[model samples]
Target: MSLRRLLLVAIALTFSFLSSFVLATPLHIIAAENFYADVAKQVGGEYVSVSSILSNPDDNPHLFEASPTIAKSIAQAKIAIYSGIGYDSWMSKLLAGHSHLTIIDVASLIGRQDGDNPHIWYDPHTMLTFALAIKQQLIRLDPAHQASYQHNWQQFVASMHPILTDIDSLRQRYAGTEVTATEPVFGYMFAELGFKVRNLGFQMAVMNDTEPSISQMKGLHNDLIEHKVAFLLYNLQVSDPMTEQLKTLAQTHKVAIVGATETMPKGIHYQQWLKQELDAVQKVLKK
Candidate 1:
């Protein structure tokens, strides 16, 4: 090649590198749930500015109403992390008006199947997939931080290895252990741990916002009375009269009660929240 041509190519490469280095900006990310917000923050590190729409732990995620302020947040967001499974369908309405933003639908990326539980975050393996997807999206939005994003993701995954190991250990220890849950929030996690679910129909009815029949409730009560269940997992949010009644029954019948939360409460991080959940399960199962 001619000297002038070689010099021009070198200059172009140098300018390209310099542009990427100078264009680094904090990523504006809007996450549907607090869990995704935490995961995105961990992966994006200091290069991201995150906001979550449904952050209240006391609210029912299944029946959340999106406000105008949330719509504006979505409009301003450069990237959005949403849980698709008909849980956050409002995001679709918001995205329809503003189509330029890159929205990452966790359900679509992970392949949502019929009868597939929407609580994907409870599954540790799915969280790893989410981390990789978040890393890729952040890298795409801010190529200059690609190396940093990758490094953060690697560290996050490495940190999750111990959690995965704990999950496996719990699975072996609690295999075939039967549990009854009022809400289906922990269905995926319990299933992963090889625990037998006693009231699947009841849980599904509650999850879909339908009322369970008297016979189903009676059967559940009988199961508790018969000592067929080892634990009674209940949602910390929502005051279901039936669930409250069942809680009393569980107390009377000596069935251990385990409270699970769909959203992390204030002042607790992701790791701490998950550790508390697992510890609750361990304590319930041991008794």
Candidate 2:
């Protein structure tokens, strides 16, 4: 071949390789919660890069303040997932100028209106629905990997089978067992396991960062002292002096206490995180 033809051939090959690289670039995703980020990772597999803002298991997610770094992340994300029942309201503010992002508000997907429990991930059903929605969004972004996304979602569903079994077992053994919470962090899961939650007014008060009514406080105290509640579901992420006092009271009264967190801990998959929590509840029940 002539020198000119050889150069043209080299250019064509380079262009072809660049096209493939562009096609293979990972989809950028941002989830407000770490669990959602984990779900996105499971569904997206090798085809995505996910960022979670409220993922530090150590910090109180309710006190999460917005920053320029997080805002920039949302601005550049191709897809953004958030629990939108006022859980991560900061995300909405950050996304105001980021209209290009495909937003998956999990609360809206479940028709969970305001005033509903914000801890939607605690509900197994909600997570399943979230996985499906995430897979659909991944397909929209990367149709070439649709099969992979579908397969991963199916695997996620399969993994839940065991957790569902655990839930059933707990329901049989501890259903109708009364529980109280510092906040409603584990309310949905408790309901799923057929445990009755008492002192909702106090839980809601704690969640809202407000003082519970004198009557509500007295009711909780009396319930704990009288052993009306079998367990105390404590919000480990947002505990304060008041919550600590309540926990001490419960401990003194010999009530089992199970701690719940707002975010997925480091290096644990979503299914494992949930199973560990359920296991804790089971242990408490056995005690």
Candidate 3:
């Protein structure tokens, strides 16, 4: 071949390689919670790469303040997933100028209005919805990988069957069981399992990071003394004097105590962390 013809062929091959590289690059995603990060990974599979802003297992997601770094992440991400429901209001503020990115507000997709509990992951049904929504969004971004995303989601749904079964069993075993928490972190899960939450005021106080009113504290004390609650659930991350007082009262009144964490600790997978939490609840409630 002539030198000119050889140069043209080489250029064509280089352009083809560059096109393949561009097409194969993973879709960038930013997830608000660690739990959603796991779900995003499963649903997106190899076609998407995810970064969770609140990754520290010890950090209370409610108390997280957004920084410039997080803002940059949000600006560059093609898809952003947030728990919403007023839980991560900072996310909305950060996303205001980014009109090109597709935002998946989990709360909106799940039909939660303002003041609704944002811990949707604890509800298996809600999680199923989240997974489906994620799969659909990912397919829209990369149609070539639709089959892979759907397949992975189907497997995820199947894998979660046991968790759903366990939830049902818990509901059957602990129906009408009275529980109290420092915050509403686990209220949705408790409600799903048929447990009556008796300390909503106290939990809401802690969730909002404010001192409970004297009346609210007095009411919680009364519930403890009157044996109105069967168990006390506390978030491990937040340090609340009221929760500490309640812990002491729980021990004195023989009320079971269960600690719940928002993040899955290092070295523990999503399923294992959830199973551990459910086991703690089962053991405490069974007593």
Candidate 4:
């Protein structure tokens, strides 16, 4: 073959290989909440592009309304994740008509039903299960990347070991200990630590943004004022007059107040977020 012809043939083969690599585009993944988006990213790695619909730590997630841009994103995504059981119902509405997308409802994935706390991600198991689910879904969606997904998922699961150890240590020392929260945002974590959560009715009412019966208010107030609970868990993203009143009482009575946010803060991944919260718990308990 002539030298020029041989060089041209080699160039054509290289172009074909490059075109094939470009064809394996990253999957578009949308998560209703930021933490789930972080998990999807951890498991999906370079194979996926993830978006979090509700990512602000200061915004009250209960009052969130979907924007047109968010809706369009969900419609075009290859996988959509939401905390089902009513946490982000707007996601369910936005996800409709896209039957081709894979949906991961963390609540239903773990057998939780409506009326259960929507913040199931607070439990380590919930996130681990979610990571595994994302891995499987990605494997099915792109079998070519199955090994990558499996390795990433394993690392994600292993990263939670320290958090699990913290949970066990807390449970050993504070199991059956009395605690209270302004809402149920950290209820699952409390359960994992085996604490007896007090004034749950008050919490549910606050979470739903409804009036907790005067008696419910009085019950929580009395718990705080009387120091019946070891610490008060308040939602940092959400606070009302009622929440403030209880927070004041907690402080005055010397009961520690632990603030928990509804969404993961920016620049911090899910694992770091959980570790910080667990550290706060340990701090309050040791006080």
lDDT values for all models: 0.85, 0.89, 0.83, 0.90
Once fitted onto the true fold, the runs of candidate 3 whose alpha carbons sit more than 4 angstroms away are 1-20
What TM-score does candidate 3 get on C-alpha atoms?
0.89
lDDT digits (tens) for residues 237-279 of candidate 1? 8687878998999999888889989887877767667778988
Against the true structure, candidate 2 reaches a TM-score of 0.92
Tell me the deviation in Å of residue 228 in model 2.
0.8
Model 1 misplaced stretches (Cα beyond 4 Å):
1-25
For model 2, residues 1-287, the per-residue Cα lDDT tens digits are 99999999999999999999887778999998899999889888898999999877877877788779888778768999999989889888888878799999999998999999898999989999999999998898789889999999899999999999999999998899998988888988989999899999998988888999999999999999999998888877775898899999999999888897778889999899899999998888887
TM-scores for candidates 1 onward, in order:
0.89, 0.92, 0.89, 0.91
Point to the candidate with the largest lDDT: 4
Candidate 4 wrong stretches, greater than 4 Å: 1-24
- Please give the RMSD of candidate 4 to the true structure: 4.0
Candidate 3 local Cα displacement, residue 88, angstroms: 0.5
TM-score of 4: 0.91
lDDT of 3 by residue, 26-67 (tens): 898998887888888888888888888888977778778988
